[model samples]
Target: MKKFDKERLLLAVAGPVIALVAAMVLTSVVLVASGKSPVEPYSLMFQQATYSDVQVLIINEAGMYYLAALAVAVGFRMNLFNIGVDGQYRLAAMVTAVVGAHMSLPAGLQIPLLIVVAMLTGAFWAGIAGVLKTTRGVSEVVSTIMLNAIATSVIAYLTLDDKFGVPVGNNNTTGVMHESGWFPGIDMGDSGEIYGFVVVAALAGVLYWLILNRTRFGFDLRATGASQSAAAASGVNAKRMMLTAMLVSGAVAGLAGMPILLGDVHTYSLSFPTGLGFTGIGIALLGRNSPVGIALASLLWAFLVKASQALDYEGYDKEIAVIMQGLIVIAVVVSYEGVRRWGLRRQQQRVGEELAAAARAAGDENNGNNDSVKEVAAR
Candidate 1:
């Protein structure tokens, strides 16, 4: 095949293969140091995860992770690190839940409305960071991190008191949303219910792929990420691209909490989940920010989490999974860098060889002409 195609194929195969190998080696070392055999723990984890109920749980968790990762992936593509996704989703979910709780619209309308509310709120929160970066020369990473702290305080204030909070027995929460706003869960035979919102998460992935691979906006975003100066020279508005990418990322992050909110909890409680946004960052890096890659990475992460739950029963530490995950992330980063270096070396070698061949061909042609001229002179 062509050199570029071959290089692409090699990178695709090499990165994950090398990363997995390195992770396994490191994890094995850890296990040995802990006085445990790596084989038995892994086998037990996998076997337990194979159970029907656990499989559903894995998918359910993956659905949420899928959305979060996609959100992070969007910002990553634009060279924007939107660390505020944690806050964006929490605030979005809180506002959407409160609004949804009060609305009595039909299911068809209410569900979409709540989703739109999520997107809008998430975009608005993220937009703050985008605006700061574009207009004030603020670093997005710093702005977003600060925004997350603010969002947490805001969510706490709104959800903790009677002003927006509803009393449910002894708990304070955004009152339960009506059935109309709930996404029905899908029942798997002998397994627990899977979140129906998984379909939405899947659709989000499709949209992400389409936008990144098929749209001018995506092209601009990627171009900007590759090199802001080059993109600016090409007349692409780098600031605008960054802002738009950040907004879109936040909008997508709004969906991150929906699986739990609509499928299971049906309310925004004090215990509403957090940290998935941070997890998304790791997953995005692991997946290399590709939509398909992120999906697989999400599943793998979910499996590790779900399977590890049984470790406690087996007298093994559940934190082992966390350790393994950390190792995998580190290894994957090293592997990608190595692959990049190897590719650069190969490309240089190829260019050098081509140049040498061309020089030899030119020398041969020039020598032949000189010999022909000499023969004519001698004759």
Candidate 2:
């Protein structure tokens, strides 16, 4: 490959490596301070990964994480922070579950209907923040934050026994979906079943890459992210792009929790998964907003989670994984900035050298012309 391309790739790889090494080193120190062996936890985690069931669990979880990260990355692309992903996801899942529970349609039709319902629900929820941002000039961060709280209250109200929720021992839930509404998964016998939505997530990643890298709307979105003034000067509708981005982001987020509900849990209960959206921000940042990078990040995160389960039995705090994850994201942010500055410096130096060479060549050419002119005059 070209030298410049190689350098870019090297820098790209270097950021993640630097972050990982820094995080590991700090985690080791923390483990030592706690009078625990860091190596032991890692070793046990690796051994646990050898089990097929654990591997299956990791894949299923990774798929869910991939979708959440994608949703967050969409906003990241537009320089918008949709912190309300958790709310959008939960509210969508809850409503989808309720709607699906009430239906008795066939799998082919029912599955798509539930999914569409989920996406629309999330879009409408997130669209509120988008509309407020475009019309009221409210910051997306502030608006999304408020929306998350409002979503929480709305969910709480919906889950009341007097509403659509059913009592389940200690927790209230949207009643389970019928068999026809369930998304069929890949059964791994005794090992476990892989969520079918994982395949859908993979497709989503492909679409994300294609749309962002290969379309006019993506160009407008990214250009606006880089500089709204430049994009607006170019005739791109910045407000429209912002609203569209939010709608797209929340729609993907709506799918984030569907795997767990449709493929495994079959209901939206108080025990249903939460915080996946928050975790996605870290993954999206770590991955640098690349679809493939995000997939790898999600897998790595899922691995850490699966490994943390055994840390408690090893006399280590399972929260170590959480600590490590936090450290990784922080380190990545710092390292990426450092690499970016270094790259910028290198590029400037390269440009300076090229300009100097061009100047020297021009000077030589001018001297030769002058010498020829003098010789011709003498002749």
Candidate 3:
């Protein structure tokens, strides 16, 4: 394979493998410290993984998680840390639920409309931060973080009031969406199985990949991401790119919440978000900010979550999963940076070698020409 391809392959494999090894070592140390065998908990987790229902649950949850991770990954590529994805997602879900609950459109129109409105809501919410950063000279990091708090407050207010409140008492939640807005599940028959949101997740992964790899817009976004000053100098419009990237990221995140709102809960509630946006950062890092990588990372996370839930039946603490996740994230972060630096060093060395070789070739050609001149003079 070409050097570039090899470098990509190395990057693709290094982080997750290193993370797995590190997580294993950490789990072993934890078990030893706790005076328990690591083997038992892992064995139980493995056992749970074999169940059909558990597998379905993992796939479903992973699909949702993948959407969130993709959203975060987009911002990461632009060197923008979008910490307010949770709020963007929540606001979108709220808007979707409210629209779905009140709209009298047919099923075909209502579902699509709800999805579009949700995406727009998320985009608008994120645009606020972008505008603040571009127009007011605020740091996107600070603005996004503050926006998350603001979104939470707004959602709380909307869901707590009787006119806007869901029937779920004083809790902050919107009323259930109408049947027209619900996503349809596929029946697998006999096996008591249903294909859930995995299809949406797969499509999302493809969409993200295409957007990044094939589009002119994506090229401009990546250019700005790599170097905002350079991009601006080249007439790429850096501020607009940043704002567009954030809006697109928010839209993706908004779609991420739809699985929970339309499929799992059938409504928007205070509990709708459930920290998936925060978890997405870990997933994005673990996946190395690639679409396929993020999808696989999400699947791995979903597996751990499902395995953790089974701990209740096996008489083990569910917190073990969280600890394992933390360990994995740390491992991936360290390894990714290490590998990236190593790759850069290697590239620099190769470039230096190529330049030296060219210089030597030029010197040899000059020497040969000198010899020819000397011989001709002697003749």
Model number with the top lDDT = 2
Candidate 3 deviant stretches above 4 angstroms: 169-172, 189-196
> How well is each residue in 1-379 modelled by candidate 2, as lDDT tens digits?
9999999998888998899999989999999999999689888888988999999999999999999999999999999999989999999999999998899898889999999999999999999999999999999899988988898899989989999899999999989889888998999999989999999999999999999999998888899999999999999999999999999999999999999899999999989889999989989988899999999999989999987898888788889988999999999999999999999999999999999999999999999999999999999
Q: What is the lDDT of residue 307 in candidate 3?
A: 80
lDDT of 3 by residue, 1-379 (tens): 9988988788679878989888988977897798877778888888988887787778778888898898899998888899888888888888889888888688889878988998899899999988887788788789888888998888778877666786565456677788888887655554233435567868888988898889988888888999999998989998889899899989888888887677767777756656888889999989888887888889899999988887777767778888999999899888888888988898899899999999999999999999999999999
Query: What is the Å distance of residue 314 in model 3 from its true position?
Result: 3.0
Q: Rank the candidates by TM-score, best first.
A: 2, 1, 3
lDDT of 1 at 348: 94
Clashing pairs in 2: none
Task: Give the TM-scores of the predictions, in the order they appear.
Answer: 0.95, 0.98, 0.93
Q: Write the per-residue lDDT of candidate 1 for residues 1-379, one digit (tens) a residue.
A: 9978988888877887788788878888889998999788889888988799988989999999999999999999998898888999999999999998888799999999999999999999999999999999999999999999999889878876667888777778998899999998898877879999999999999989998899988899999999999999999999999889989999999999999999999999878889989989888888889888888889989999999999999899988889888888888889999999998999899899999999999999999999999999999
Query: For model 3, where is the 10-residue window of minimal lDDT?
Result: 188-197
Question: Model 2 has how many clashing residue pairs?
Answer: 0
Error of 2 at 249 (Å): 0.6
The list of candidate 2 runs beyond 4 A from truth reads none
- Model 1 residue 258 lDDT score: 96
Q: What lDDT does the true structure give each of the candidates?
A: 0.91, 0.93, 0.84
